[model samples]
Target: MIKIGVLIPEQYKLLSVAAILEVFEAANKFQFASELKETFDITLLTINNQVDSFFKTYKTDTINTEEKFELILIPSFTTNDIKNTIALNRAYIPWLIKQYNSAAEIATFCTGAFLLGATGLLDGKAATTHVDACAAFSAAFPSVQLKADKTVTQDGRLFTSGGATSTFHLLLYLLQIHCGKDLAIKTAKIFAIDMDRHNQSYFSSFQPLRHHNDEIVACAQEKIELNYQDISTIEEMIKDIPSSRRNIVRRFKQVIGITPIEYLQQTRIEAAKKLLEQTAQQMTEVIYNSGYNDPKAFRKIFRKTVGMTPSQYRDKFQAR
Candidate 1:
C-alpha cells in the first residue's frame, strides 16, 4: 500500500485537510465491493496532539519522529498571520527536513508553502502560494523561485499549489505521477475539476501592507493612491513629502516590498480588474478610468500582470 501522512498542525485550514483526507479515502475506495480492497494507507499526524477539534472524529496519532511515510502533505493555515503560524509550528520543520532527506515526497497547499519555505527546502526551488500572499512569501524566502502565476509548481519532490481550489490540482498531479493518469482523471471527474486551469494570477487582488511606520513611504503611497488618476509621476507625487526621492524610494521598497511606481501600477491594475469584472464599459474607458493614458501599454501591462488579455479576463471573471 502507498502510505501517506497528512500533517495536522495548529491553525490549519479545515477545508485543506478535509479535502486531502477525502481524496485519499476516495482513492482507497475507488474499487469498492471488489477483492482489490483498499490501496492507500492514510494517516493523520497531529502536532503535539493539538489539532483542531473539527478533526477529532478522525483517527489520528501524535507525530512519531521515528515513523516514516512515502509522502507527506502540509495543509494551508487559516490565518494570514503566516510568520507567526510558521513559528508556532516550528517543530515540524526538522521533521519535514528529515522526511525529505529520507526520500519522502512533500506536498504543500496554498499558504502551507510558508511553513515548508521556513525549512529552507524550498530554497532555489520553484514554488507557488496563495496569489495574494506571493509578495509576503517572496520577501520571507527570497531564495525560493516564486511562480506567482502558476496554479501548481513542482521542484524535485517538493510540490506546491496556489490558493484554495488549486489544492485539488496538486492532488491530481501527485496521483498522476504515482498512481496513473487514469486514476488522476477519475478523481478529477468525481470532483468536476477543470483540469485545464493553470494560471492563478487573474484571481489575485493586489493588497499592499500599510502597517509600517515609515512616514515618508506612507506619504508617497498616499500621494500615488489618492492621485492615481492624476498624470503625476512618482517623482512629482513625492515632491511635497519632506524626504528626498532617493530616500523615499529606499524606505518604500523596504517597507512595502515594491517600489512606489510599481505600487501605483498595481493599484491601477486592481482598479482596471474591478472595471473589467463589474462594468461593460468600452476598453478605452477602462484604460482612461484606471489612470492609463495609452491603450497599448495598458494591455501589455495587464496581460503581463494578470496573465490574460483584458477581453479574456472580462469574459472569464465578468458577472453574468
Candidate 2:
C-alpha cells in the first residue's frame, strides 16, 4: 500500500480536506474491488492531535514529528492572509522537510503552495497557486518560478495546482501516475471533471492590490485605473503625480510587482474582459473603449494574457 499523509494545518479549508479524502477513498475502493485489498494507507496528520467533530468518520492522527510517507498532501487554507496562516502552521515546516529528505513526494493545492513555500523546499522550483494569489506568491517567494497561467505545475515530486476546480486536475494527474490512466479516466467521469484543462488564465480576475501604504504608488495606480481608457500612455496619465517618472516607476514596481505601464495594460485588459463578458458591444468598440486604438495590439495582448482570443473568451464566458 502507498502511504499517503494528508496534513491538516491550521485554517485548512474543509472542502479541500474533504475532496482529498474522497478522491483517495474512491481510489482505494477500486483497489479493493480488483485486488481484494486497499492500495492506500491514508491518514490525516495534524500538529495538535485534534480534528473537528465534522471529520469523525475519517482517520485522524497527530503527526509523530518523525515518519515517512510515499506522498504528502498540503491542502489550501481558508484565509487570504497567507503570512499569518503560515506562521500558525509553522510546526509543519520541519516535519515536511524531514519527510522530503526521507524521499516523500509533496503535493499542494491552490494557496497551499504558500505554506509549502514557507519551508524553503519550494525555492528555485517551478510552482503555482491560486490565480488571485499569484502576485502575492511571486513577491513572497522570488526564488520559486511562478507559472500563473498553468492550472497545475509539477517540479520533480513537488506538485501544485491553481485554484478551486483546478485542484481536481492535479488529483486526476496523481491518479494517472499512481493508479493508471484507466482509473484516472473513470474518476474524472465520476466527478464530471474535464481532465483536459491545463491553463488557469481565463478564470482569473485582475485584482489590483489597493491596501498597501505607499501613497505615491497608490496615486500612480489610481491615475492608471482612472485614465486607462482616455490616456494614450501611462506617463501622460501620471505626469501630475508629484514625482519623477523614474521614481514613480520604481516605487510602483516595488509595491505592485509590475511596472506602471504593465499595470495600465492589466487595467485595460480587465476592462476589455468585463466588456466581453457582460456587454454585447462590438469588438472594435470594446478595444477602443479599453484604451486600445489598434485592434491588432489589443487582440495580441488579450490572447497573450488570457490564453485565448477575444471571441473565444466571449463565447466561453459571456453571460447568458
Candidate 3:
C-alpha cells in the first residue's frame, strides 16, 4: 500500500489541498476497479499532537519512516510561516528529512517549496515556488536552485510548484508518474481543466538572460516554434533538448527570468493576442486552436496576465 501524507499548516490553500486529495481519490478508485481493492493509505498530518476542534487540525500522532510512503505533499504556507519554521523548527523538519532519507517521494505546491528549502535538502537542487514569492525564496535560501517558468518541478525525489493553480499541474505530474498518463488525462477532463492549457516542462530550461543565452534558449524556442500547434510531455522535451531535466530547469530559469510554464503561458497568450488582433476567427475557434479547451479559463488567464479580456484585447488592437 502507498501511504501518502499531507503536511498542513493553518489557512492552507483549500483548493490545492482538495486537488491533491481528489487526485489520490481518483487513483484509489481506479485501483479499486482494476484489482477490486484499495491500493493507498492516506493520512493528513500536523505538527503537534493536538486536534484543534474549531478548525479541524488533527494532531500528528506518529512518525515512522520505516513504513514506506509513496509520496509526501506539502501545501503553501505564509511567508511568516516559512521564515519561522525553516530556520528554527526541528519538530517536523527532522521527520521530513527522515522521509526524504527513506524511499518516499516528496513534493510541494506553491510556497510549500519554502519548507523543503528549510530542510537544506534542496541545496543546488532544482525547484520552484509561486512566482510572486521567487525573490523572497532566492534571498532566503541562496543555495537552492530556483526555476522561474515552471508550474512544478521534479528533482529526484523532490517536487515543487509556483502558484495556487499550479497545484493541479503538480498533482497531474505525479499522477502521470505513479498512476498513469491516461488517469492524469481523465482527471484533467473530470475537473474541466485544459490538459494542454499550461506546459510545466517549458520552465525546465528558462533563463533570466533574455538575449545572451541564445544557444540553449533557442533550442527550446525552436521547438516551440515548430510544435506550437502540438504539445509534448516533459520527458519528450528532455529527449529533444539534450539537457538533463534538472540542468534544464536550473539553466532555463536563469536565462528566461520566468519558468517554462510561464513562458508557454506567455507564448500562448501572445499567440491568442495576435490571433485576436489580426484574424476574424471566432473566440471559440481562437481558444481551441490555441490549445485551451476552457474559454472561461482562457479569458481568466488572459485577463489576469494581459490585463484585459480577449474581446477587449481584440477591440483595442483592432482600433489601433
Candidate 4:
C-alpha cells in the first residue's frame, strides 16, 4: 500500500481537506468493489492530532513523529493572510523537511504551496499556487520557481496546484501516478471534474504587482496604468520619470516582477480584455485601443497571456 499522510493544518479550507479525503476514499471504494487489495494506507497527520475547521472539529489518526510517509498532502489554507498562516504552521516545516529528506513526495493544493514552500523543499523547484497569490508567493519564496501560468506543477517529489478547483487536477494526477490512468479517469468521472485542465492563465486576473515599496517604480506603474494607450516606449516613460533608463528598468523588475515593457503589455492586454468583454468592438479597434497597431502581434500576445484567442475570450466572457 502507498502510505499517504494528509496534514491537517489549523484553520484550513474545510472543503479542500474534505475533497481530498473523499476522492481517496472513493478510489479505495472502487478498488474494494473490484475485489482488489486496498492501495492507500491513508493517515490524517497533524501537529496536535486534532484540528478545528470553520464548521466542525476533526480528530484523526496521526503519523508517528519519527515515521516517514511515502507521500504527504498539504491542504489549501482558508485565510488570505498567508504570512500569518505560514507562521502559525511553522512547526510543520521541519517535519516536512525531514519527510522530504526521507524520500517522501510532497503535494500541495492552492495556498498550501505556501506551507510547502516554507519547508524549503520547493527551493530551486517549479511550483504554483492560486493565481492571485503568485505575486506574494514569488515575493516570499524568491528561490522557488513559481509557475504562475501552470495549473499543475510537478518537480520530482514536489507537486503543487493552482487555485481551488485545480486541487482536483492535482489529486487526479497523483491518482494516475499511483493507481493507473483508467482508475484516475474513473475517479475524475465520479467527481465530474475535467481531467485535461493544465493552465490557470485563462482564469487569472492580470493584477500587476503594485504593493512592493518602490516609490519610483510605483510612479512608473501609475504612469503605465494611466497612459498605457498613449505611451509608446520605455524611453518616453523614462523621460517622464526622474530615474535613468537602466535604474528604472532594474527597479521596475525588482519591485514589479516583470520588465516595464512586459507590464505595459499586460496593462494593455487587461484593457483589451475589458473592451472585448464590455463592448462589441472590432478586433482592429480593440488592438488599436490596447496600444498595439499590429493585429498579428496582439493576437499572439493575447493567446499567450490569456490562454485563448481574442475571439474565443470574447465568446467565453463577453457581457450577456
Q: Which candidate should be chosen as best, given lDDT against the real structure? A: 2
Give lDDT tens digits, candidate 1, residues 119-173. 9999999999999999999999999999999999999999999999999999989
lDDT of each: 0.89, 0.90, 0.71, 0.89
Per-residue lDDT value at 66 in model 1:
81
Encode model 3's per-residue lDDT on 104-203: one tens digit a residue: 7999998888878888899999988877567668877888888755667889999997786788878888888876798788778777766553433222
Instruction: TM-score each candidate.
Output: 0.96, 0.98, 0.59, 0.91
Best by TM-score: 2
Where in model 1 is the C-alpha error above 4 Å? 33-37, 50-57
User: Cα deviation of 28 in candidate 3 (Å)?
Assistant: 1.3
Query: Which pairs, if any, clash in model 1?
Result: none
Ranking by lDDT: 2, 1, 4, 3
| Number of residue pairs clashing in candidate 1, backbone atoms closer than 3 angstroms, sequence gap of 3 or more or interchain | 0
lDDT of candidate 1 at residue 1, scale 0 to 100? 81
| Model 3 spans with C-alpha error above 4 angstroms | 51-60, 64-66, 78-81, 85-90, 197-320
Please report how far candidate 4 places residue 310 from its true position, in Å. 1.6
Off by over 4 Å in 4: 53-64
Show the lowest summed lDDT stretch of 10 residues, model 3.
201-210
